[model samples]
Target: MKINFSSKTKILLYFSVALILGFSIINTVSFFYIKSYIDKNLSKDVEIFKRIYMYEDQSKLIPYLKIVDSNQNINQNDIVGKVDGKYIVVDKGKVYTELIHFIISISLWEIFILFIILIIANHLVQITIDKEKELKGILEVFILALTHKIKNFLGIQRVNIEILKINFNEKALMRLEKAYMLMEKDFEILIQALKSLREFRDKREEIDLKTVLEEIIKELESIYPEKSIFIKLSSFKVKADRTDVKNIFFVILENAFKYSEKRIFITDSMEKNIYTIKVLNDISFQEKGSGVGLEIAKFLANKYNWEIFNQSSDDEYIVYIKIPKK
Candidate 1:
């Protein structure tokens, strides 16, 4: 038979068992100590009873000084007499031991406290498990989408490149070359996205920030030879994975050109322990249908614990990335 239980019920069952076991052990130890204390007091009471019954050297019953163990509930008349010129009174231990009363009285309160602690521990464990499951699902979906796109783009690029290699005529060859070039550009973008995912797999190191920016700009300029981007260098360092650094710039550069109809200005600065890279273009934000470039850039920046800012004034749109100085 398949056994099934709701999540709440399962948590309660486990918590109750743990709470019971812990409280049971504590009560057992407390009971043992209380029992030992009571036994010690009872032995002392026997000696006190002997002294009360003795009647000088004659050792005969005086009737007035009758010995009575404190454990026995004597009449008021029996306890109204003195023993050997001293008034007799019962010791407090004979009526009830403090340790025994304390153990029994606090058992309920201790059990209540234990129940509260167990409930909190169980809930915390459940919350952590749920959040971990959610993050895993998101990462799995991202990896699947990236893999599918990369495979399809590479297949097309491979076919075109092979065709271009076979052609000898200049006219046909030139057209094939252009087609292969465009396919290759798209493939590079896909590859950059893949590298961004790779950083999530425990691969991060100090990368040369300036060198990565230079390479991305070179690749972007290859597509539009007439288009130009000015670079401003800053003496700063970043502790980020090489793949991640390259992808960050690649996404931003792609976004700048896609939205702007003119030249893009790229500048870098280091102030107050922050390494900021700004991509400025003469364009304002507009409603575009399903674009992932800016979204991915922001995602990568936030994932690396870097700050991203986007602002527009007049006709200039600025994208700023602030990485912590390493």
Candidate 2:
């Protein structure tokens, strides 16, 4: 079984590993540091007083310091060490032992405190993430509901407009028809905007490259008659969701015409099972558009074996999309 971790989870795991490793090294190094301190300093004391009974009278001055003769048997605190180029028996008791214990205990306490902080931080982060997820679910539901209501209202307006078109004179009807076009376009945009972008694949089938591009071009021709589009599509069928592929191409082509100064070029290339589409146009530099079409295409591209990227300069904009071809 495979488990996929989020980026946040990966970061937290890395931090936790480093935290453990860092403290482990600190404790190890600290133990050795104190080991050498006791070896050098306490061993020298044994060289000064060569017998355990020699320090018995000075017990109040140096507690737990038991320096003894080389042949003397030591208690639990005894250790064999070299002092002044001679062998000695030494018992460095609570003085050095307490220091070692204090150091290790302090490191453990630090580890405990930091681990508690990490737990609290992770708990807070998880809470925030849960809240965000809940808010996103609520927002998606709200937008879906609002868009649906607007779609129904727009459908009614479309029907009433079509019915009343017969009653108006030529001049009034022309104005009404233009207004109708604007309303339909706006509603189409609204529907596209709120449509569940997360659902990219409702159905997958072979979609012809040339036919879909030409159909999308025809729709734009009625809207932007002055713009010229030159298409050079490769002969291939792309195995993908029809609506998704169409929406992506439509957005690319529509943006080309909508923002082009005069000329828009459409071309495609195929290699093995991959098809690449390129849309190139000179920037119009007119009133900027909403670019909701390209946004929709980008959202769809992220979900499939498709790639969409673009480059632009002061005068030209070029976009490329790579898709799987059957």
The ten-residue window of minimal lDDT in model 1 covers 57-66
lDDT of 2: 0.69
Q: Mind giving the per-residue lDDT tens digits that candidate 1 earns over 1-326?
A: 99898676677788778778877888888887777776575556545555545445322322223444556666664354344454444444434556657776778788778778767877886876765664565466455545654565566557666776886556555545554665566567556655655554636786777778788778767765655677886555666666656666776786676567567898888789777888898763553313355655665676678988888777778888888775
Error of 1 at 29 (Å): 5.0
Give me candidate 2's TM-score against the actual structure: 0.44
The number of clashing residue pairs in model 1 is 0
Please report the candidate that would top lDDT against the real structure. 2
C-alpha TM-scores of all predictions: 0.54, 0.44
